[model samples]
Target: MAADSRAARPLQKMFSEVPATYDLINRLFTLRLDQAWRKIAAKECMRENPRLVLDLCTGTGDLALSMAGQARPGMHIAAVDFSLPMLLEGRLKFVAPGQRVGFVLGDVGKLPFREGSFDAIGIAFAFRNLVYKNRERDKYLSEILRVLSPGGKLVIVETSRPRSPLVRLLFHWYMRTAVSFLAGLISGRGAAYKYLAHSAINFYSSGDLSDLLESAGFRRVQYRTFLFGVCALHLAYREGPGNMENS
Candidate 1:
Protein backbone atom coordinates (compact mmCIF):
# COMPACT_ATOMS: atom_id res chain seq x y z
CA MET A 1 0.00 0.00 0.00
CA ALA A 2 2.83 2.40 0.80
CA ALA A 3 4.47 1.67 -2.51
CA ASP A 4 1.18 2.10 -4.28
CA SER A 5 0.61 5.46 -2.61
CA ARG A 6 4.06 6.55 -3.65
CA ALA A 7 3.37 5.70 -7.23
CA ALA A 8 -0.04 7.34 -7.16
CA ARG A 9 1.23 10.64 -5.77
CA PRO A 10 3.24 11.42 -8.86
CA LEU A 11 0.38 10.51 -11.17
CA GLN A 12 -2.16 12.47 -9.19
CA LYS A 13 0.01 15.54 -9.18
CA MET A 14 0.73 15.22 -12.86
CA PHE A 15 -2.95 14.91 -13.76
CA SER A 16 -3.98 17.77 -11.50
CA GLU A 17 -1.42 19.98 -13.13
CA VAL A 18 -2.43 19.13 -16.66
CA PRO A 19 -6.25 19.30 -16.55
CA ALA A 20 -6.22 22.71 -18.21
CA THR A 21 -4.48 21.39 -21.29
CA TYR A 22 -5.04 17.67 -21.02
CA ASP A 23 -7.77 17.39 -23.62
CA LEU A 24 -5.97 19.65 -26.05
CA ILE A 25 -2.74 17.72 -25.65
CA ASN A 26 -4.58 14.44 -26.11
CA ARG A 27 -6.17 15.68 -29.32
CA LEU A 28 -2.83 16.81 -30.65
CA PHE A 29 -0.94 13.71 -29.64
CA THR A 30 -3.44 11.15 -30.91
CA LEU A 31 -4.52 13.19 -33.92
CA ARG A 32 -8.05 13.27 -32.50
CA LEU A 33 -8.33 9.46 -32.66
CA ASP A 34 -8.67 9.30 -28.89
CA GLN A 35 -12.24 10.56 -29.16
CA ALA A 36 -13.13 7.84 -31.63
CA TRP A 37 -11.54 5.18 -29.45
CA ARG A 38 -13.56 6.24 -26.43
CA LYS A 39 -16.72 6.18 -28.50
CA ILE A 40 -16.03 2.61 -29.59
CA ALA A 41 -15.43 1.52 -26.01
CA ALA A 42 -18.62 3.23 -24.89
CA LYS A 43 -20.60 1.45 -27.58
CA GLU A 44 -19.28 -1.88 -26.35
CA CYS A 45 -20.27 -1.10 -22.77
CA MET A 46 -23.80 -0.14 -23.82
CA ARG A 47 -24.26 -3.38 -25.78
CA GLU A 48 -24.90 -5.17 -22.48
CA ASN A 49 -27.82 -2.80 -21.83
CA PRO A 50 -26.42 -1.98 -18.45
CA ARG A 51 -28.65 -0.04 -16.09
CA LEU A 52 -25.78 1.23 -13.99
CA VAL A 53 -22.38 2.04 -15.49
CA LEU A 54 -19.18 3.20 -13.87
CA ASP A 55 -16.43 4.84 -15.85
CA LEU A 56 -13.27 4.43 -13.82
CA CYS A 57 -10.23 6.58 -14.38
CA THR A 58 -12.47 8.65 -16.55
CA GLY A 59 -10.09 11.48 -17.19
CA THR A 60 -12.09 14.48 -18.42
CA GLY A 61 -15.13 12.20 -18.84
CA ASP A 62 -14.72 11.49 -22.56
CA LEU A 63 -15.83 7.86 -22.23
CA ALA A 64 -18.55 8.81 -19.80
CA LEU A 65 -19.92 11.40 -22.21
CA SER A 66 -19.90 8.86 -25.02
CA MET A 67 -21.74 6.34 -22.88
CA ALA A 68 -24.34 8.91 -21.85
CA GLY A 69 -24.83 9.98 -25.44
CA GLN A 70 -26.25 6.54 -26.30
CA ALA A 71 -27.60 5.58 -22.90
CA ARG A 72 -31.15 4.46 -22.41
CA PRO A 73 -33.45 6.80 -20.55
CA GLY A 74 -33.03 6.65 -16.76
CA MET A 75 -29.73 4.81 -17.09
CA HIS A 76 -27.15 5.94 -14.52
CA ILE A 77 -23.58 6.80 -15.46
CA ALA A 78 -20.97 7.63 -12.82
CA ALA A 79 -17.56 8.83 -13.90
CA VAL A 80 -14.82 8.76 -11.27
CA ASP A 81 -11.28 10.03 -11.19
CA PHE A 82 -8.85 10.98 -8.47
CA SER A 83 -8.16 14.36 -9.98
CA LEU A 84 -10.79 16.85 -9.01
CA PRO A 85 -9.62 19.41 -11.52
CA MET A 86 -10.06 17.00 -14.35
CA LEU A 87 -13.51 16.03 -13.17
CA LEU A 88 -14.48 19.67 -12.85
CA GLU A 89 -13.22 20.43 -16.30
CA GLY A 90 -15.22 17.56 -17.69
CA ARG A 91 -18.35 18.59 -15.86
CA LEU A 92 -18.09 22.10 -17.25
CA LYS A 93 -17.40 21.17 -20.85
CA PHE A 94 -18.87 17.76 -21.67
CA VAL A 95 -21.86 17.35 -19.38
CA ALA A 96 -25.19 18.43 -20.80
CA PRO A 97 -28.33 19.48 -18.99
CA GLY A 98 -30.30 16.49 -17.71
CA GLN A 99 -27.48 14.21 -18.80
CA ARG A 100 -26.98 10.98 -16.89
CA VAL A 101 -23.23 11.34 -16.52
CA GLY A 102 -22.25 12.29 -12.95
CA PHE A 103 -18.65 13.19 -12.31
CA VAL A 104 -17.13 12.03 -9.03
CA LEU A 105 -13.72 12.31 -7.42
CA GLY A 106 -12.46 8.90 -6.40
CA ASP A 107 -9.79 6.28 -6.88
CA VAL A 108 -10.31 3.28 -9.14
CA GLY A 109 -8.11 0.91 -7.10
CA LYS A 110 -10.37 1.38 -4.09
CA LEU A 111 -13.74 2.19 -5.56
CA PRO A 112 -16.28 3.65 -3.12
CA PHE A 113 -19.12 1.43 -4.14
CA ARG A 114 -20.79 -1.71 -2.92
CA GLU A 115 -20.13 -5.16 -4.24
CA GLY A 116 -22.24 -6.12 -7.26
CA SER A 117 -23.15 -2.49 -7.68
CA PHE A 118 -22.37 -1.79 -11.31
CA ASP A 119 -23.52 -3.56 -14.46
CA ALA A 120 -20.81 -2.15 -16.68
CA ILE A 121 -17.49 -0.37 -16.29
CA GLY A 122 -15.26 1.39 -18.79
CA ILE A 123 -11.69 2.60 -18.52
CA ALA A 124 -9.69 4.42 -21.16
CA PHE A 125 -5.94 4.97 -21.52
CA ALA A 126 -5.45 5.04 -17.76
CA PHE A 127 -4.96 1.37 -16.90
CA ARG A 128 -1.21 1.61 -17.15
CA ASN A 129 -1.09 4.20 -14.40
CA LEU A 130 -2.90 1.80 -12.07
CA VAL A 131 -0.06 -0.69 -12.47
CA TYR A 132 2.29 0.70 -9.87
CA LYS A 133 3.35 -2.84 -9.01
CA ASN A 134 2.05 -6.35 -9.62
CA ARG A 135 0.13 -6.33 -6.35
CA GLU A 136 -1.35 -2.94 -7.08
CA ARG A 137 -2.56 -4.15 -10.45
CA ASP A 138 -4.16 -7.19 -8.82
CA LYS A 139 -5.88 -4.98 -6.26
CA TYR A 140 -7.40 -2.83 -9.03
CA LEU A 141 -8.69 -5.85 -10.93
CA SER A 142 -10.06 -7.35 -7.73
CA GLU A 143 -11.89 -4.16 -6.84
CA ILE A 144 -13.31 -3.91 -10.35
CA LEU A 145 -14.52 -7.49 -10.21
CA ARG A 146 -16.00 -6.97 -6.79
CA VAL A 147 -18.08 -3.99 -7.87
CA LEU A 148 -19.41 -5.56 -11.07
CA SER A 149 -22.64 -7.54 -11.03
CA PRO A 150 -22.67 -11.15 -12.16
CA GLY A 151 -22.03 -11.37 -15.92
CA GLY A 152 -21.33 -7.64 -16.07
CA LYS A 153 -18.84 -6.34 -18.56
CA LEU A 154 -15.64 -4.30 -18.32
CA VAL A 155 -14.33 -2.51 -21.36
CA ILE A 156 -10.77 -1.19 -21.55
CA VAL A 157 -9.23 1.05 -24.19
CA GLU A 158 -5.48 1.42 -24.01
CA THR A 159 -2.27 1.61 -26.00
CA SER A 160 -0.83 -1.77 -27.02
CA ARG A 161 2.42 -3.19 -28.27
CA PRO A 162 2.50 -4.57 -31.79
CA ARG A 163 3.33 -8.22 -32.46
CA SER A 164 5.55 -7.49 -35.42
CA PRO A 165 9.10 -6.61 -34.43
CA LEU A 166 9.47 -3.92 -37.07
CA VAL A 167 6.21 -2.20 -36.21
CA ARG A 168 7.04 -2.45 -32.53
CA LEU A 169 10.34 -0.72 -33.12
CA LEU A 170 8.79 2.15 -35.02
CA PHE A 171 5.97 2.53 -32.49
CA HIS A 172 8.41 2.76 -29.63
CA TRP A 173 10.51 5.31 -31.45
CA TYR A 174 7.51 7.52 -32.17
CA MET A 175 6.16 7.31 -28.64
CA ARG A 176 9.51 7.84 -26.96
CA THR A 177 10.68 10.68 -29.15
CA ALA A 178 8.01 12.46 -31.15
CA VAL A 179 5.04 12.04 -28.83
CA SER A 180 6.95 12.93 -25.70
CA PHE A 181 8.55 15.97 -27.28
CA LEU A 182 5.41 17.29 -28.90
CA ALA A 183 3.13 16.76 -25.89
CA GLY A 184 5.64 18.39 -23.60
CA LEU A 185 6.02 21.36 -25.90
CA ILE A 186 2.30 21.89 -26.15
CA SER A 187 1.37 21.13 -22.55
CA GLY A 188 4.45 22.73 -20.99
CA ARG A 189 4.82 19.68 -18.79
CA GLY A 190 7.73 17.87 -20.26
CA ALA A 191 8.19 15.45 -17.38
CA ALA A 192 4.54 14.48 -17.36
CA TYR A 193 4.50 13.79 -21.09
CA LYS A 194 7.75 11.88 -20.76
CA TYR A 195 6.19 9.68 -18.10
CA LEU A 196 3.15 9.07 -20.30
CA ALA A 197 5.36 8.14 -23.24
CA HIS A 198 7.39 5.79 -21.09
CA SER A 199 4.26 4.17 -19.69
CA ALA A 200 2.86 3.54 -23.17
CA ILE A 201 6.04 1.88 -24.31
CA ASN A 202 6.14 -0.37 -21.25
CA PHE A 203 2.42 -1.28 -21.00
CA TYR A 204 1.33 -4.87 -21.54
CA SER A 205 0.53 -6.36 -24.93
CA SER A 206 -3.05 -7.23 -25.84
CA GLY A 207 -2.74 -10.97 -25.16
CA ASP A 208 -0.97 -10.47 -21.84
CA LEU A 209 -3.50 -7.91 -20.66
CA SER A 210 -6.32 -10.28 -21.54
CA ASP A 211 -4.61 -12.98 -19.49
CA LEU A 212 -4.33 -10.58 -16.60
CA LEU A 213 -8.04 -9.86 -16.75
CA GLU A 214 -8.82 -13.58 -16.80
CA SER A 215 -6.59 -14.17 -13.79
CA ALA A 216 -8.56 -11.47 -11.99
CA GLY A 217 -11.73 -13.58 -12.29
CA PHE A 218 -13.12 -12.22 -15.53
CA ARG A 219 -14.17 -14.64 -18.28
CA ARG A 220 -14.80 -14.50 -21.99
CA VAL A 221 -11.90 -12.10 -22.28
CA GLN A 222 -11.30 -10.82 -25.80
CA TYR A 223 -9.59 -7.83 -27.42
CA ARG A 224 -9.48 -6.04 -30.75
CA THR A 225 -6.33 -4.29 -31.89
CA PHE A 226 -6.28 -1.07 -33.92
CA LEU A 227 -3.83 1.41 -35.44
CA PHE A 228 -1.37 -1.20 -36.58
CA GLY A 229 -1.70 -2.83 -33.15
CA VAL A 230 -0.69 0.32 -31.31
CA CYS A 231 -4.05 0.48 -29.56
CA ALA A 232 -6.61 -2.10 -28.36
CA LEU A 233 -10.07 -2.44 -26.92
CA HIS A 234 -10.47 -5.26 -24.39
CA LEU A 235 -13.79 -6.67 -23.32
CA ALA A 236 -14.24 -9.14 -20.50
CA TYR A 237 -17.21 -10.38 -18.54
CA ARG A 238 -17.64 -11.38 -14.94
CA GLU A 239 -19.04 -14.86 -14.74
CA GLY A 240 -22.01 -15.69 -12.54
CA PRO A 241 -21.76 -16.05 -8.75
CA GLY A 242 -20.78 -19.71 -8.82
CA ASN A 243 -17.85 -19.13 -11.11
CA MET A 244 -16.76 -16.06 -9.19
CA GLU A 245 -16.84 -17.85 -5.84
CA ASN A 246 -14.33 -20.45 -7.00
CA SER A 247 -12.17 -17.90 -8.74
Candidate 2:
Protein backbone atom coordinates (compact mmCIF):
# COMPACT_ATOMS: atom_id res chain seq x y z
CA MET A 1 0.00 0.00 0.00
CA ALA A 2 1.16 3.49 -0.83
CA ALA A 3 1.95 5.55 2.22
CA ASP A 4 0.21 8.89 2.75
CA SER A 5 2.52 10.71 5.06
CA ARG A 6 0.37 13.82 5.01
CA ALA A 7 -2.71 12.08 6.33
CA ALA A 8 -0.72 9.94 8.74
CA ARG A 9 0.82 12.83 10.65
CA PRO A 10 -2.44 14.48 11.61
CA LEU A 11 -4.03 11.20 12.61
CA GLN A 12 -1.05 10.32 14.76
CA LYS A 13 -1.25 13.66 16.49
CA MET A 14 -4.98 13.51 17.00
CA PHE A 15 -4.91 10.02 18.49
CA SER A 16 -1.90 10.91 20.59
CA GLU A 17 -3.84 13.68 22.30
CA VAL A 18 -6.73 11.50 23.44
CA PRO A 19 -5.28 8.26 24.92
CA ALA A 20 -5.86 9.38 28.48
CA THR A 21 -9.62 9.71 28.04
CA TYR A 22 -10.15 7.58 24.94
CA ASP A 23 -11.68 4.57 26.67
CA LEU A 24 -13.89 6.68 28.91
CA ILE A 25 -15.16 8.79 26.02
CA ASN A 26 -15.82 5.71 23.95
CA ARG A 27 -17.83 4.13 26.77
CA LEU A 28 -19.86 7.30 27.16
CA PHE A 29 -20.49 7.69 23.45
CA THR A 30 -21.55 4.10 22.88
CA LEU A 31 -23.42 3.79 26.20
CA ARG A 32 -21.03 0.98 27.20
CA LEU A 33 -22.19 -1.08 24.22
CA ASP A 34 -18.65 -0.92 22.90
CA GLN A 35 -17.64 -3.47 25.50
CA ALA A 36 -20.31 -5.90 24.35
CA TRP A 37 -19.30 -5.34 20.74
CA ARG A 38 -15.68 -6.21 21.51
CA LYS A 39 -16.80 -9.26 23.41
CA ILE A 40 -18.73 -10.53 20.41
CA ALA A 41 -15.81 -9.81 18.11
CA ALA A 42 -13.49 -11.70 20.42
CA LYS A 43 -15.84 -14.66 20.50
CA GLU A 44 -16.07 -14.75 16.72
CA CYS A 45 -12.29 -14.51 16.22
CA MET A 46 -11.45 -17.17 18.78
CA ARG A 47 -13.82 -19.78 17.36
CA GLU A 48 -11.04 -21.52 15.40
CA ASN A 49 -8.51 -21.57 18.23
CA PRO A 50 -6.12 -19.35 16.33
CA ARG A 51 -2.61 -19.58 17.75
CA LEU A 52 -1.41 -16.17 16.57
CA VAL A 53 -3.80 -13.22 16.22
CA LEU A 54 -3.27 -9.74 14.87
CA ASP A 55 -5.37 -6.78 15.89
CA LEU A 56 -4.96 -3.99 13.35
CA CYS A 57 -5.37 -0.34 14.17
CA THR A 58 -5.81 -1.47 17.72
CA GLY A 59 -6.17 1.84 19.52
CA THR A 60 -5.77 1.36 23.26
CA GLY A 61 -5.82 -2.40 22.53
CA ASP A 62 -9.41 -2.93 23.67
CA LEU A 63 -10.24 -5.69 21.20
CA ALA A 64 -6.85 -7.36 21.73
CA LEU A 65 -7.34 -7.37 25.46
CA SER A 66 -10.78 -8.89 25.04
CA MET A 67 -9.35 -11.68 22.90
CA ALA A 68 -6.48 -12.32 25.29
CA GLY A 69 -8.92 -12.74 28.16
CA GLN A 70 -10.35 -15.95 26.71
CA ALA A 71 -7.50 -17.14 24.53
CA ARG A 72 -5.78 -20.49 24.93
CA PRO A 73 -2.66 -20.82 27.04
CA GLY A 74 -0.22 -20.55 24.15
CA MET A 75 -2.17 -18.00 22.11
CA HIS A 76 -0.28 -14.81 21.31
CA ILE A 77 -1.89 -11.56 20.22
CA ALA A 78 -0.07 -8.68 18.54
CA ALA A 79 -1.97 -5.41 18.66
CA VAL A 80 -0.64 -2.75 16.32
CA ASP A 81 -1.29 0.96 15.89
CA PHE A 82 0.54 3.92 14.38
CA SER A 83 0.24 6.08 17.43
CA LEU A 84 2.91 5.43 20.06
CA PRO A 85 1.01 7.24 22.75
CA MET A 86 -2.03 5.08 22.19
CA LEU A 87 0.03 1.91 22.41
CA LEU A 88 1.77 3.15 25.55
CA GLU A 89 -1.52 4.06 27.14
CA GLY A 90 -3.00 0.70 26.30
CA ARG A 91 0.04 -1.08 27.71
CA LEU A 92 -0.20 0.88 30.91
CA LYS A 93 -3.92 0.50 31.45
CA PHE A 94 -4.96 -2.85 30.01
CA VAL A 95 -2.00 -5.23 29.74
CA ALA A 96 -1.40 -7.23 32.89
CA PRO A 97 1.64 -9.21 33.96
CA GLY A 98 2.00 -12.40 31.88
CA GLN A 99 -0.64 -11.22 29.42
CA ARG A 100 0.09 -12.42 25.89
CA VAL A 101 -1.16 -9.29 24.19
CA GLY A 102 1.74 -7.25 22.85
CA PHE A 103 1.11 -3.68 21.74
CA VAL A 104 3.25 -2.76 18.74
CA LEU A 105 3.84 0.56 17.03
CA GLY A 106 2.99 0.00 13.39
CA ASP A 107 0.83 1.09 10.47
CA VAL A 108 -2.14 -0.75 9.01
CA GLY A 109 -1.39 -0.04 5.36
CA LYS A 110 2.11 -1.46 5.78
CA LEU A 111 2.12 -4.26 8.30
CA PRO A 112 5.58 -5.42 9.36
CA PHE A 113 5.19 -9.17 9.21
CA ARG A 114 5.96 -12.05 6.93
CA GLU A 115 3.33 -13.37 4.55
CA GLY A 116 0.80 -15.71 6.19
CA SER A 117 1.94 -14.91 9.70
CA PHE A 118 -1.29 -14.65 11.65
CA ASP A 119 -3.96 -17.24 12.24
CA ALA A 120 -6.70 -14.66 12.69
CA ILE A 121 -7.14 -10.90 12.63
CA GLY A 122 -9.53 -8.46 14.27
CA ILE A 123 -10.21 -4.78 13.91
CA ALA A 124 -12.78 -2.63 15.72
CA PHE A 125 -14.02 0.87 14.94
CA ALA A 126 -10.69 1.77 13.29
CA PHE A 127 -11.27 0.39 9.80
CA ARG A 128 -12.87 3.61 8.61
CA ASN A 129 -9.74 5.56 9.41
CA LEU A 130 -7.83 3.59 6.77
CA VAL A 131 -10.24 4.65 4.04
CA TYR A 132 -10.17 8.36 4.53
CA LYS A 133 -9.15 9.10 0.93
CA ASN A 134 -10.87 6.07 -0.59
CA ARG A 135 -7.66 5.09 -2.37
CA GLU A 136 -6.14 2.93 0.35
CA ARG A 137 -9.09 0.75 1.30
CA ASP A 138 -8.36 -2.00 -1.18
CA LYS A 139 -4.65 -1.80 -0.49
CA TYR A 140 -5.28 -2.23 3.21
CA LEU A 141 -7.51 -5.22 2.55
CA SER A 142 -4.88 -6.77 0.33
CA GLU A 143 -2.28 -6.29 3.02
CA ILE A 144 -4.54 -8.02 5.51
CA LEU A 145 -5.02 -10.91 3.12
CA ARG A 146 -1.31 -11.11 2.45
CA VAL A 147 -0.41 -11.52 6.10
CA LEU A 148 -3.21 -13.90 7.01
CA SER A 149 -2.45 -17.60 6.80
CA PRO A 150 -4.51 -19.64 4.43
CA GLY A 151 -7.88 -20.24 6.08
CA GLY A 152 -7.26 -17.56 8.66
CA LYS A 153 -10.29 -15.61 9.83
CA LEU A 154 -10.90 -11.87 9.86
CA VAL A 155 -13.37 -10.18 12.19
CA ILE A 156 -14.27 -6.54 11.73
CA VAL A 157 -16.43 -4.39 14.01
CA GLU A 158 -17.44 -1.03 12.62
CA THR A 159 -20.25 1.49 12.64
CA SER A 160 -22.85 1.13 9.95
CA ARG A 161 -25.90 3.01 8.67
CA PRO A 162 -29.25 1.63 9.72
CA ARG A 163 -31.59 0.25 7.03
CA SER A 164 -34.67 2.05 8.24
CA PRO A 165 -34.90 5.56 6.82
CA LEU A 166 -36.03 7.16 10.07
CA VAL A 167 -33.36 5.42 12.10
CA ARG A 168 -30.71 6.30 9.56
CA LEU A 169 -31.63 9.95 9.68
CA LEU A 170 -31.66 10.03 13.46
CA PHE A 171 -28.40 8.15 13.68
CA HIS A 172 -26.73 10.50 11.26
CA TRP A 173 -27.99 13.46 13.20
CA TYR A 174 -26.74 12.06 16.48
CA MET A 175 -23.34 11.26 15.04
CA ARG A 176 -22.94 14.65 13.40
CA THR A 177 -24.26 16.64 16.32
CA ALA A 178 -24.61 14.91 19.66
CA VAL A 179 -21.62 12.61 19.34
CA SER A 180 -19.34 15.35 18.14
CA PHE A 181 -20.55 17.73 20.82
CA LEU A 182 -20.18 15.24 23.62
CA ALA A 183 -16.83 14.04 22.39
CA GLY A 184 -15.61 17.60 22.21
CA LEU A 185 -16.78 18.22 25.74
CA ILE A 186 -14.99 15.14 26.95
CA SER A 187 -11.77 15.24 24.90
CA GLY A 188 -11.50 18.88 23.92
CA ARG A 189 -11.18 17.77 20.30
CA GLY A 190 -14.46 18.69 18.65
CA ALA A 191 -13.04 18.82 15.15
CA ALA A 192 -11.40 15.41 15.46
CA TYR A 193 -14.66 13.91 16.67
CA LYS A 194 -16.51 15.61 13.83
CA TYR A 195 -14.14 14.03 11.35
CA LEU A 196 -14.72 10.67 12.99
CA ALA A 197 -18.49 11.15 12.84
CA HIS A 198 -18.35 12.10 9.17
CA SER A 199 -16.12 9.14 8.35
CA ALA A 200 -18.54 6.65 9.90
CA ILE A 201 -21.56 8.12 8.14
CA ASN A 202 -19.72 8.03 4.81
CA PHE A 203 -18.20 4.54 5.17
CA TYR A 204 -19.38 1.77 2.89
CA SER A 205 -22.36 -0.35 3.86
CA SER A 206 -22.01 -3.82 5.34
CA GLY A 207 -22.80 -5.45 1.99
CA ASP A 208 -20.20 -3.35 0.22
CA LEU A 209 -17.59 -4.23 2.80
CA SER A 210 -18.42 -7.89 2.41
CA ASP A 211 -17.85 -7.60 -1.32
CA LEU A 212 -14.55 -5.94 -0.66
CA LEU A 213 -13.53 -8.83 1.53
CA GLU A 214 -14.42 -11.31 -1.19
CA SER A 215 -12.42 -9.36 -3.72
CA ALA A 216 -9.44 -9.63 -1.41
CA GLY A 217 -9.68 -13.45 -1.53
CA PHE A 218 -11.78 -13.93 1.56
CA ARG A 219 -14.69 -16.40 1.56
CA ARG A 220 -17.62 -17.34 3.71
CA VAL A 221 -18.34 -13.69 4.41
CA GLN A 222 -21.06 -13.05 6.96
CA TYR A 223 -22.11 -10.07 9.03
CA ARG A 224 -24.47 -9.25 11.89
CA THR A 225 -25.79 -5.82 12.75
CA PHE A 226 -26.27 -4.56 16.26
CA LEU A 227 -27.95 -1.65 18.03
CA PHE A 228 -30.61 -1.43 15.33
CA GLY A 229 -28.03 -1.61 12.55
CA VAL A 230 -25.96 1.25 13.87
CA CYS A 231 -22.96 -1.11 13.99
CA ALA A 232 -21.96 -4.37 12.32
CA LEU A 233 -19.65 -7.31 12.96
CA HIS A 234 -18.26 -8.96 9.82
CA LEU A 235 -16.72 -12.42 9.74
CA ALA A 236 -14.81 -13.76 6.77
CA TYR A 237 -12.07 -16.29 6.03
CA ARG A 238 -9.10 -16.46 3.73
CA GLU A 239 -9.65 -19.48 1.55
CA GLY A 240 -6.93 -22.13 1.58
CA PRO A 241 -4.60 -22.77 -1.37
CA GLY A 242 -5.92 -22.91 -4.95
CA ASN A 243 -7.82 -19.73 -4.15
CA MET A 244 -6.93 -16.69 -6.23
CA GLU A 245 -3.49 -15.32 -5.33
CA ASN A 246 -2.19 -18.48 -3.74
CA SER A 247 -3.51 -20.58 -6.59
Top candidate (lDDT): 1
Q: By TM-score, how accurate is candidate 1?
A: 0.91
Error in Å for residue 164 of model 2: 0.6
- lDDT string, candidate 2, 151-219, tens digits: 888899999868888888999999977788888778888878888888888777789888877877788
For each of the candidates, the C-alpha root-mean-square deviation to the true structure, in angstroms, is 4.1, 3.8
The sequence of per-residue lDDT tens digits that candidate 1 reaches over residues 1-247 is: 0112324566788998888889988887789999999999999888857789999998788888889898988679998888877888888766467676767777777888899888888999998888634457778889999999988888999999899889999999999777799878878999998998888888899999988888878998989999999999999888885322232
Residue pairs in candidate 2 whose N, alpha carbon or C atoms collide under 3 angstroms: none
Report every candidate's CA lDDT. 0.84, 0.82
lDDT at residue 150 of model 2 (Cα atoms)? 87
Q: Which residues of candidate 1, in runs, are more than 4 Å off?
A: 1-8, 132-135, 241-247
Clashing residue pairs found in predicted model 1: none
- For model 1, what is the error of residue 67's alpha carbon versus the real structure, in angstroms, after optimal superposition? 0.7
